[model samples]
Each structure stands twice: as C-alpha cells, then as structure tokens.
Target chain A: MTMKLWYWPEIQGRGEFIRLALEAAGIAYEDCARVSGADALIADLDARKGRAPFAPPYLDIDGFTIAQVADILLYLGDRHDLAPSRIADRYWVHQLQLTIADLVAEVHNVHHPVAVMDYYDDQKPEAARAARQFREERLPKFLDYFEQAAECNDGPWMIDHRWTYADTSLFQLIEGLRYAFPRRMATLTPDYPALARIHGLVADLPGIRQYLASNRRIAFNEQGIFRHYPELDDE
Target chain B: MTMKLWYWPEIQGRGEFIRLALEAAGIAYEDCARVSGADALIADLDARKGRAPFAPPYLDIDGFTIAQVADILLYLGDRHDLAPSRIADRYWVHQLQLTIADLVAEVHNVHHPVAVMDYYDDQKPEAARAARQFREERLPKFLDYFEQAAECNDGPWMIDHRWTYADTSLFQLIEGLRYAFPRRMATLTPDYPALARIHGLVADLPGIRQYLASNRRIAFNEQGIFRHYPELDDE
Candidate 1:
C-alpha cells in the first residue's frame, strides 16, 4: 500500500522536505492533503489516535503514523537506504537534519516573534527586531555551518559524493532564504560558496530537476515559510 | 575505545540529556570538557573542519562525531538497543523525543526572546512577554501533548514497558521546568498526571536513580536552560 502524506493543500510548507525525498528516491506515495483539501487532512489527522501525530505533515504507513519533519525525514532515509551506512555517520546526518529543523523553527519565529497565536501584522514591530537579528546573526551562522558541511567532502553533497537528506534540506534552506530575503540573500550568497554549490548540485539532480519543473513543486509564495518583504530583506 | 562527550562544565545544559543516556546504559565515556575547562570545548569545536557539529553536546566515538540532542539520544538508543524492536514503535519514540527537543528550545527562548545573541538583560521586555505567552499557552500545549503520548501506552514508559529515550527526556524536561518555573510548575503539575508519573517512574530506574543521586548529574542553575527567577514563574 502507498503511504499517505497529509500537509497543506497549497503551499509546500514543512511537507516539502518529505515530498522531495520521496520524489528523489522514486518512491510512490499519495499526497493525500494536496490531492484533496485541508478538510481531508484535518479529518485524517483527527481519525488517528493512541499513537497519532502531534501536528500536520504526518505520514501514514500500514497502521502506524509519525510526525515531526526531522523524524519523517530520518524514517524515510532509513527505509530507503538514503542515509549514511556507518552508525556514527548516520548520527552526524541526523545531527545536520536536527539543526536544519532548528533553523526552520527560527525562520518561522522571525515573523511570529511574540507568539504563534499572534499574526504577522500584530507582531510586525517585534518581527522587525527579530528579523534583523535573524538576517544578521542566524542566517549567517546557519549558512556558514552548511557551507562547512558541504566542504566536508570533495563533491557537493554533505556526505561524500552521494546526495543525502542534508543536501535536500540545504537546498530548501538556500531556496527559502533567497525567497524570503532576496536582497539579503544576494549579499550573503557570495560568502557561502560550498552551500551555493550544493544548492546548485541538488537542482541539477535528475529527480530534483524533474520535480522542480513539474506542477507538483509549488511556487514560493507569501503563505510559505519564505516570504519576501523588502523591509525584511535588507542587505 | 570509549566515546568522548563535550559540553558545559557546570549545570545540566542541553548536554545533560546525552550524559544521562550514557550513564543509564552504563556506557563508559569521557566527559571531556567537564574534566578540562570551557576552553577545551572551544578548541575542540573550532578545530572541527568541514561537516563539523554546529554546537556542543557532541560525542566523539573514535573519529566520528554527532550533535543535536534528540538525534544523539536516538542514535545511542539504536546502537545500545535502548529502543523498541518494532520499526513503528521506535518511530513513535523518536517523534516524542523531537517534541521534547521542541519544548526545550521554547523553554530556552522564554529567557532569550529578542535575540539569542543579545544579553538576557537586553531582552527582558520581550522575554517577559514571551514568558507570559509560554506559561499560558506553550507550556500546557507541550505538557498536554506529552501527557497524551504517555497515556497512549498502558505503562509508565512511552513504549511497551521499556524505558526508551523519550522517558529519559521527559525526566529532564520535568527537572528543567521545576528549576526554571517552580511556582508555575507547581500549579501546572497536577494537570499532567501521566507525565508526572513517568517523571517519577524514571527516577526509580536503577541507573537513572543512581545518576540523579550521584554528583555526576549537575544541579540546575541560572547558567543552564532552567533558571529560577521569581518574576518569571509567577502565575
């Protein structure tokens, strides 16, 4: 049976990370929410119990369900043999994935500074301060960390020449930053040579190449993780 | 050969999760930075080249290293047979661990709201707002989620009569919450009976019980994730 993935019907959101991996591996799965609507997604999530997911972007396989972006990615990696073989190396790959998760959380926080319950407009003033710090401090720190990771091996992927989950995640990170802070990303891109190279390489991958061109790969819009606001994108 | 774990010299920081797991498993590992000083951590971290850990609480087993708290716990769990035998069950345990990590990050943010780089004093106003929201919304949301997770199973553990990594993490979360928000935690404790039971159960594990009583488990302080500020804990 095909696994069911439930996420936002329109934007990629956190689900894109899992979708990209499934696509890259040539795996077959139903994009349940995207195929239907948000109502179906909510119903499916609500139907689950005992061991149900805490939030959305959950994957249903057999009788079990799982959530958390990193958890999903790691589970897929292990099942597909897409992660590192050596235990220690696998640990490192997961470490990178967790760090990526942390970055994604912080990226969301920049807009929802006061609380997730508050709107971007309500927290815009606080977001201005938070975004400045994110653009100045975290973006650079996270980008540099990925840059260093890419440089670990001679080729573009984080682990040796083969593409791992971190490569796809790094690609998303670069893409999100570029979409969210065009001017700032333009200024910062030149510094992270290895990260840029990895991003470019991921785009050139046969599976990623096909997926990006298809309608399945949604556009980066304001509703997505990366939002473009001129004020938030200062160089 | 034994593993080498490096973290802060004092307080049960994020690194303590790794330390607790290692101790519970009766694994022999060196606490490098604790034996040395903070300088050792800086040098070891800085000396790492490409694909290095983003921060501390990294374990070096032979030449390979790993970072990220939940990732570390899961990796060690897998290697040590500290997880459930079934794939789906193990996945649930991981999902729970990631949730704890999420809560841990939120707990840290209550004290550092404006910018992680900015001083605590500089971010007091923002932190106060954040703490209010966190206490009112986030803490219960997280605690309720964990309570549900614990209640899913029949026993005290997250899984079927096994002390998985999630149990250990919840124990740490309780300790951290108690240290950081005593009054708030006291009022909130009765609301999460399952989680409180698991916390109390974890304290009874031979290894964990010994670890808590021993001098190895450092006391929580202002420098750690949980800090007691009378103003921060008021209901």
Candidate 2:
C-alpha cells in the first residue's frame, strides 16, 4: 500500500516539501488531507502508535511515521534511491538540508517575526520592519551562503553533478524566495550565478518538470510561507 | 585525553547546554577557548574542512568535529550514556530536543528581529515590538508545550526522571528566559509550574550544583543569547 501523508490540504506549507519530493521521485503516497479533510489528518496523527511525528509533513512507511523535513526527505532519499550511497556524503546531504530548513524558518519570519501563531496581519507592524531587513540583508546573505556551498561542488547541485535532496530543497528555496521577494530576488538573481544556473537546471529534470506543472504543487499565495507583499519588496 | 570543546570564551551562549550536560554526567572535557584564546576558537572552526559545523560550540572528538546545538548534545548524549538505549525512546529525545531548538531560536529573536549582526541597541526599536509579542504570546505558548511534555513523564525530568540532555537544555531555556525578560517571566512563570519544577530540580543536581558554583560554568551576561533589557520587560 502507498504511504499516507497528512497535513493541511488547502496550503502546501511544509507538507508541500514532502509532496514535491514524493512526486518528483514518482513515489506512491497519499496526501491524506487532499483526499479527505483536515480532520482525517488529525485522526491519523492521534492514531499513531509509538514515537510518531510530532506534527504533519510526516511519512507513514509500513506503520512508522517520521517528521522533521530533513529527516523525512533523508528517509525518502534513502528509500527511493535519492541520496548518495556513502555515509559521509549522506551526512553532508543532511547538513545541506538543515541549512535549507534554516532558510525556511527565516522566510516565515519575514512576515511573522515574533510568533508563528499570530497572523501576518497581527504582526504587520513588525513585518514591515522585518521585511525591510530580510530583503536588504537576509535574502542576499542566505543566497551567498548557499552559493558558496554550490561552489564547493565540482559542478551543479550541492555535491557534484548528481542531484541530492539538497538540490531539490535549494530549488524550492529559490522558487519560494522568488515568489515572496520577487523584486528583491530580481535585483540579486543574476548575482548568484551558480544558484541561478541550478534553478534553471532542476526544471529540466523529468520528475521536477512533471511536479512543477502538476496540480499537486500548490501555487505560491499569501496563505503560504513565502507570501509576496509588494510593500515589503525593494530593488 | 579529554574531549576539546570550542566556543566563544566569554558567553555561555549555546555552549552551556553541552557544557552543563557533560559536567552533570561527570564527564571530563577541556574548554578550548579558555586554554587558548578567542582567536583559537575561530581558528579551530576555520581549520575544520568539508561540511563541518556552521559555527562554534562544536566538539572535537577522534579528529572529527560536529556542530548544531541539538546534534552536538545528541552526540554527547549517546557517547556518555545520557540518551535512551531504545531507538523509539531516543527518537522522542530528539523530537523534544528539536522543539527546544525552536524555542532557543525564538529567544534569540526577541532581541534580533532585524539581524543578529546589527547591535541590539540599533535593533532595540524592532526588538521592543518583537519582545512584546514574544513575552505576551510566544514564551507562554512554547513553555506550555514543554510543560505538557514534562507532564508526559511521572517526575521532574523530561523522561521518567532521567537526567537527559533535554533536562539540562530545559534548565538553560528557563534560565535564559528569566534573564531576558525578568518581569515578564515573573508574571508568566507561575503558569508553567512543570517547567519551573524541572528548572529548580535540575539546578539541584550534584554536577549542576558544582558547575554553577565553579568558574567552569559561564555567567548569564549581556553578550550572550539571553540578555535582559528592562524596557522590553513588563508584567
């Protein structure tokens, strides 16, 4: 049976990460929320037996469910033959993924600076200040860091020419940043040539192209993490 | 030979979490920065090659160093027999640890809403708004989560009265919160009695007592992750 994945159906949020990777790899899994409702997702979590994922974006393999975006992807990477074979390379793969997770947290904080529970509307006053700092300082700083990592590789992707979970994650980061901070990303897009090159290259992969075009991938919107607020953008 | 730990010399910062656990476990390790200097800490990290720790507070073991606070603690937890032996129990250890990592990031952000690179004085205006929301909403919400987890066990520690790294990290979290927002924590402290219980209990541990009294443990000063700004604290 295909694995059952549960999260909010309406928005991609963190769950989309699992969705995108699963779809890209052509792995069989059910996005439980989309099939049923958020209630089903809750029931699934409540029904988990031992050491289940703390929250959604979890993968239920056989009967075990795992959480943490990087951990989940690493699990899938190993299962579906996405990760490198060597132990050291796998460790580096996870390290790169953790860096991606770091950027994801920062992206969310652009609008919800102090608390995640509060709406961007509630935090709008703070978001303006955060957005300015993010666009001017954060986006470039993070991009530069990733760009350096990419340069560490002999070619494209985080580790050599072959794609790893980190590459897909970096691709997601690029797409999300472009969506959230288009004006700012536009200004710095050409600067991160390696990242820009990988951005274009990942789309050429058969699985990624299918995933991007399919309805499985939710379009970027205000409800999601990388919501583009024009006022928060600058050249 | 004792393991060599590298981190900033002056501040407890992230290093204290590891330091406390090691000290509490009666494990011996040398503080690399104190014996050497601040430059040595930087030099150690600079000299580390290939997908090493992103920054300081890394431990040098068998010629290999790893970073990330949670990862580092987990490393010591396994080696020092601090973590659970069972895989399932250990997963819970990591899950709770990851959650604590979230709170740590939030604690740091109370003062660095704009950027950590910028001075707190420069970001004080931004920090005020961030700290207000943090104290009013985030702190209690996060503490409530930890309190619930603490209640999962029968006793004071996170898991079955065992003095795991989670307990030590929780101690630091509580201490940091108090230092950062004394008046706010004073008003809110009563609500998280479980966490406070755990806090007081961990402090009384023999190793913790010795470490606290000894110069080995760094003090809570303004330069660390937790800093008290009177203007940002209120009932």
Candidate 1 local Cα displacement, residue B194, angstroms: 1.2
Which lDDT tens digits does candidate 2 get at residues A60-121? 77776677676677667767877888765665676677667777888888888755677878
> What C-alpha lDDT, on a 0 to 100 scale, does residue B73 get in candidate 1?
80
Count of backbone collisions within predicted model 2: 0
Per residue, candidate 2 scores C-alpha lDDT tens digits across B14-103 of 888889888889988899898898998888776755556666778877676666677676667667888877665665676677777777
Deviation (Å) of B188 in candidate 2: 4.0
CAPRI verdict (incorrect, acceptable, medium, high) for model 2 = acceptable
Model 1 Cα displacement at B12 (Å)?
1.1
Number of the top lDDT candidate: 1
Give the poorly placed runs of model 2, Cα more than 4 Å off: A39-55, A60-65, A74-82, A121-125, A154-156, A160-162, B43-49, B78-80, B154-156, B190-193
